[model samples]
Target: MINKRLTFCHENWSLREPFRISRGVKTCADVIHVAINCDQVTGQGESVPYARYGETTESVLDQIEEVLPEVEGGTNPEELLELLPAGAARNAVDCALWDLMARWQGRSVPELFGLEVQRELETAITIGLDTPEKMAKKARMNRRAPLLKVKLDQENILDRVRAVRIQAPESRIILDPNESWNMDILRLVDEELAGLGIDLLEQPLPAGQDDGLREYRPKVPVCADESCHTSQDLPALTGKYQYINIKLDKTGGLTEAVRLRELALGQGFGLMVGCMVATSLSMAPAILLCSGADFIDLDGPWWMAKDREDGFNIQNGIIRNISGNLWGGTEKAEAAVS
Candidate 1:
């Protein structure tokens, strides 16, 4: 087998345009491509930004560059956990290795990971920053998407939710305030979200503010996004959140992500798999984590104006090519031996 070297270039995909949220957004998301080659076949992975962790595209690139020697020297994903902290750079390299190992052995990643199957996962299409009316319009346009995640800032929470609910009355909604709300708003808006048929609310308050949520309850279940990263972040979140948003970038890569999901499920925390704006290569390995996830939010690549050559497909909001079945520009399905 040809031991493939890790060589990559930065890709900047412009959002068809910038979609603002209360926090902020840009016209583009900087992505990194990580590939593993074994002479006979090559496998790839991708990753994106996580500003919450003070990570920019430049920072992520720098992290990978720091680990250049190890990755080239044939660092396995297990050893990678020590070389790099959990973030976009590590996520790409780690996932690339898993993909490479699977392809080299002539097995699907899930199969090699000892996973039963890569089932159909329903994903949530995000409605980025717009006035309440415009967001409502966006929701209306996504008629085929089974679920819609309504992005909220601290301001005008109810108006935006009301608008979106009005446009797609039959659809299920999830509200993500990106850690902008507090105990007060959470209580005030609880009734409104329930009336609008919102399924859940995610990270309404800043991570530190979660202490305030202790002993307090809201009408809808609150999920921890920024507050919960790995299993280590779970202990403090016990009484506050009923759900946890698992992201490989946050946990470093799929290696720890799977463990975190199992731990979260055992702790009675519902699961949601979310993503930053990345390519299909970035989302491919994450499909494995969605097996028991209650909500799927892998819509990062779909927002890009142009994606990588072998990215997954999002049909009517359902992730059609998530398991790498539709990759490499071929329509053939990869089946496991009976």
Candidate 2:
């Protein structure tokens, strides 16, 4: 076994403004950054401990520590999947290993997977949940963005969506209720949302309770977020969702995320790559999964008050560039913790 070193720490990146979703609001992004060193080469990754998944920083830290010995003994991404479940802990380590391998091979992660990295890709700009007037204002501010992801809940569903639709009539819109709506609400709003030109509806119903979607057809395409994680969950999501939102954190990292994407597409599911509110270190690895995705919602770093040097360049909802020194590149990884 190759001698290696593993280290991790918790980081809190303050958001420029509070990001509100159906569940709650977040003013800071709490994440865990992991690094693995071998033969004087370092690779790094980051993950957000999602409260919606019952993950806390402490819990994630403990999970990583428990696997420290095996990781330092030179475990690969495939082996790390068996060591940790699909969540934030495995995500960090898995991504770090991928970055390490890519560096060792003198290629970018996308190249390692036989994929070409786009110089610029259009991404969705998120407008967090708020009052109709406030939401409209936010939409107006980002009207130039190619795509706008509007956060909504059960309350004022029509009002909120209508407000955003009126502000940015030309921008492609995605309504994400974040598992806050019931079948009745979805049925009631489906036609109206379709008429309003809402492009996609994400996870209207909660996980384990969305079996009702099997019989209900909607005017708008539905994407599964909370309801789907790895490829194992794809079987259950087959008839219910038209698209699956693949987030590395939810899939345990790019390793499973790639498998999930391939399997989901084979099963006739469209793709949407997403991310929790996090730093560029987290979003950098996700870029590999965005090649043929139908919807890209990787604006996590756009919400940060400040980002790391040599991070992704996002302007007007388009990711223009990803520096080589970032997470999954051929260049050496820098210290990612703040």
Candidate 3:
């Protein structure tokens, strides 16, 4: 049996700018960092508290504390599934275990999971909900990026899309309403958004209120973010959502996230790997899931004022390589030239 020192801490990272969704606005990212010290090697992971899921920093910390005894007594990642419900707390502990196990076995997490570590990935930069001119300015700044994820709310839907489209004419656009739209709003934007060169629409209506999507199909592929969390969600999301966004924070960790991806693929759902505004520690493990994703939204760290040491290399819109020793392997992975 292996004994490990399990510990968790809460850290708040100030975002470079305020990020807004359908729910609210946030100026900082409150994250829980978990570390497992086994023998001589130490592994680390991070999870951002998501209010949309009714999660708070204090609540997640308590959840980790509840399972500390078992975690320190050599409970592996697989066993953690039964111990905690899928959420931010379990995600931190599970990823920490995976990181520790990878180092102990002398293999990277991707290699251990039988995945080829992606060398270059095109990730969508997020433009938070704001005034049309402001959002358009943000889009103009990132016009060189290959993909831009525009955050929308109930108001300024068309204005936001039109402004961003004019500013970043060549960039592929995706809309993430974050469950702020109703049937009327969806009906209102249908014709215009279809011609706005948008590639995807995410969570237009509130979860459980999205049954209307079954009868209405828009020109752009619609994705599920707040609605789909685990593999169990794939069944109900069949006709409603053409794509599903996979975030480790939502699925608990990479263990379940990988499982969700396989099941999602089996169900003919397009996969999009996303992340919250956390650190490199959180985003490191998620990079492996972007292998064949139709859209990648791992720009959480880009919104931070400063990220953890040796973060992923992002140039324009492309994420070139995973940096640092956050996950498996050495401090630096061989990066392709940008």
Q: Which candidate's lDDT is highest? A: 2
Q: Report residue 213 deviation for candidate 2 (angstroms).
A: 0.6
TM-score of each: 0.93, 0.96, 0.96
List candidate 1 segments past 4 Å from native. 323-334
Per TM-score, the best of the predicted structures is: 2
Q: Candidate 2 residues 155-258, lDDT tens each?
A: 99999999998999899999999999999999999999999999999999999999999998889999999998999998899888999999999999989998
Model 3 stretches with alpha carbons more than 4 Å out: 331-338
Candidate 3: how many backbone clashes? Answer: 1
| Tens digits of per-residue lDDT for model 3, 133-180 | 999999999999999999998898999999999999999999999888
lDDT on C-alpha atoms for all candidate structures: 0.79, 0.89, 0.87
How many clashing pairs per prediction, in order? Answer: 1, 0, 1
* Model 1 lDDT tens row, 1-338: 44667766688778876767778877887888777676767767777767778888788888888887777777888899999887888888888787777777666767666664454567899999689888988988996788889888878888988888888887778899888787887888798778778898999899887787888777788899988878889999999899999998888888889889889999999999998887777777778788788899998878888876656678667876544542211122244511
